[model samples]
Structure formats: C-alpha cells, structure tokens
Target: MSSQARRRSRGTLYLALCGLVLACLGFGAALWAQDHTTWFKRLRGGNAWSLTYQGDAVGGQGSALTIRYRFNPDSFKPAHRIEQLGRTHLPWSVHALVNTGEVARVEVEPEGHTVATCRILLDDVRVVAEGKSPAPGRPAVCDVTTSSTPEKWPR
Candidate 1:
C-alpha cells in the first residue's frame, strides 16, 4: 500500500499495544481486588500476624467467606508498627456471608467492647464479631478461638 497508509497502520498498532497493556493491568487488579475491610487487606502486627483463615463462612453454595485473625505489635521490627496492615483495621460496620446468602450484618467493634452487645440485623439475618484491646502494658493481642490457646509474637 502507500507509505502514508503504512505509517498510519504502524501508529494504530502502537496504540493497540498500549491498550492491551492497560487492559492486562486492569484484569490483574480485578484478580487482586479486595473489600476495604477484608481481614487480610490491612494486615498489621508485621510478619507475626499469623493469619489462620478458612472458607467456612459460606456453606456449599457460597462464593465468599469471612476470615478472622489476630496480631501482636511485637511480632516484627517495632519500627514497621502497624504499617503492614495498610489503613485497614476493625470497622464498626462491615460485610460477611452466611450459609444461605449474603450476611450483610458483619459488625466491627472497638477492642474491649461487649462482644455480644454489638449485633446488626439486616432484613432477617445478623452478622457479628468483637474486638479486645490488649490489657495495659501487655501490648496488643487477639484471641481467634475459645480454646485456651494464647499466642505471643515477639519482635
């Protein structure tokens, strides 16, 4: 064809390559997309954050699950502090799932607040969780289960 036509085609190809690169980046983001208050998003406590998560929130027909974990500020280099968790932490209100469908009743409570007192009802379901700040001079600690298992992460 003509030189002008060839040049135009070349320019179109460059633009197409750029578009493809951006599309790939977008797809990558979607794969990594996470809810703002997702337990694993704003992880803190440094590497000491032993994240024990499971897909038990939803039954057999569910696509998402609620995760619970704990962190001790002494788990890593103290300088990093809570930076590892980004800006995420417990929220007064959040979302989780249940056996049947969406459990939009997830509740975040300030550590030390009444665990049972904080509950939200949406339509006909309720989601709940609680937080407990470490006792003074004890650093931050979390108990994910009822068993007598207390873990301490030393820096």
Candidate 2:
C-alpha cells in the first residue's frame, strides 16, 4: 500500500480502538450503577425473619428463607445457626421487639458475645434513628439499625 493508504489504515485502526474503549467504559458504568444499589433487605415478623438480596435491578416482591426463626414475640440474632447460613455474601439482619418497643437494630456483635453487647457499626448513616437525621436542624431518624461492610464470603 502507498504511504497515504497506510496512514489511512492506521487512523481507522486507532478509531476502532477508541470505539472499543468507549464501549467498555459504558459497560463498566452500567455495572457500577447497579452495584451501587445492590443491597439486602430483611423484614421481621415477630420472631420469624424474612431475608432477600436484590438480585435484580428493578425491585421484585421479596424472598423467603426455607429455615425460618420460630421464636417468641421477637428475638435478636434469631439466625438458624451459623451452619445453616451456608457460605454467602448476603448480609445478616435481625429485628426483635424487645421491651424497648419498635426500637430494634442490627449490629455485628461479637459472634461469641464474649467481647461486647450492642456495639453498633451503623449503616444508613444519613438517616439515623427516626429523629436523628444527619441534617442540622432535623432530629436524627430512628426506627432500626443497619450496617454493612465490603467484606464478603463465597459460598
């Protein structure tokens, strides 16, 4: 090919490479948007706990665990035994109606419970307990306690 022809071919190749890079970047952005919203939800019904992960982007109804926690009116850490959890990345949550009333929270207390009690690694920092919001004038929010860490385990 002539010099001019070679230059044209090189330019075309460069453009193709740029296009591929842009496509890759777009795909990465989409994945990030989804991952940013990826989360787990658990709603408590007295003692029984229902847990589910948002496996999809748009919301679905919900999911139920085969092993349910059948306990009294409510109990914290009502997990079905550590062995029952199965290796998983899903976050663990529990809601209990202690004498504290609707005020229940989830925290990664010392698994052995020998270290501490009610040590909160709080999530939803922006909206704290129902009244204690992060905002200045508004009282912090309160209702439930939730926290999560990037750490995960594989099943």
Candidate 3:
C-alpha cells in the first residue's frame, strides 16, 4: 500500500480502538450506576433480609452458601428467597413466605453426601445467632454468620 494510504488505515484502526474502549467504559459506568441506585433504594426501603453461611466440605470440596430473602414492604411477606451452594451458578430462587422468627435453618445436601446445616437466629432485622454443622460424616465443620444491617453493610 502507499504511505498515505497506510497512514490513513492506521488512523482508522486507532480511532476504532478508541471508540471500542470508550464504549466499554461507558457501559461499565452505566452498570455501576444502576447497581448503586438499586442498593441505595433497598437501603432506604428497609425491607431486606439475608443469611450467610460457610460450611465444611460436603463432598470433595468446601461449601459456600448464601441465603437471601427479600420481603414485600407493605405486607412484610417474603417476595423471594434465593439459596446458593457450592460453585454452581444457578439462579435458584423461590417466592415463598419465610416466617420471621427467632431462628432460621438452612441445609444443603449434595446427592449421596451428608447434609450441611446452618442455623441462624433472627433479632428483628438482624442476625443474633449463627451456627453451622458439618456434613454428617465429615469432621470439618463450617461457621456461618450474617452480615450487618443495610446501613452498616460495606459498600
């Protein structure tokens, strides 16, 4: 190619690259803004419930568990309950009423493996008691705890 043509081609490539980078950054900023807005709304709404657990290795690997319950602001009924375990990234959520009581129990049992249990005590909107039991046959036990209130939650 001629020198002038090559220079034009390089300039076009650089412009395209810059455009792509700016597009990505703009998209990322938009996502971040949306997340921050949603979080702030939830905090202001004051109707979020959560349970976090760390359990022993059930099968061959350690267990990472999270239980989240979102309640309706007007009715105080659970809008959704999400439970996650292990490394599986499944969107497993159930719409049900999770009674607000002194204790909440969550258990996970991988097929053919012993059960890992988390017992949490609820004090109004805070978790007052948290405990975990290892899988039936496993000697390693996992400890579970709840995050602080929304106002105190880390950003």
C-alpha lDDT score of every prediction, in listed order: 0.31, 0.31, 0.42
TM-score of each: 0.29, 0.27, 0.28
Candidate 2 lDDT at 35 equals 70
> Residue by residue across 1-155, what tens digits does model 2's lDDT show?
89999999999999999999999999999898767642322233222222221111112222222112111253444332221222222123343222212233322212211221121122222223322113222211123422222222111
Best-fitting candidate, scored by lDDT: 3
Tens digits of lDDT, candidate 3, 89-155: 2222233223222123344433234434333333334444333334453322222322323324322
What would you estimate as the lDDT of candidate 1? 0.31
Lowest lDDT sum, 10 consecutive residues, model 3, at 88-97
Candidate 3 ranges with C-alpha deviation above 4 Å: 41-155
Backbone clashes in each candidate structure, one number apiece?
Answer: 4, 15, 0
In the order shown, what is each candidate's alpha-carbon RMSD?
17.2, 17.6, 14.2
What is candidate 2's CA lDDT for residue 58? 13
What is candidate 1's lDDT per residue for 1-155, written digit by digit as tens? 99999999999999999999999999878777643333342244222322321211111221111223322334333222121122223222232212111111221222222221223322224222222323311212222221111222111
**Candidate 2 wrong stretches, greater than 4 Å:** 39-155
Model 3 alpha-carbon miss at residue 13, Å: 0.2
Q: Pairing residues by index, what is the TM-score of model 2?
A: 0.27
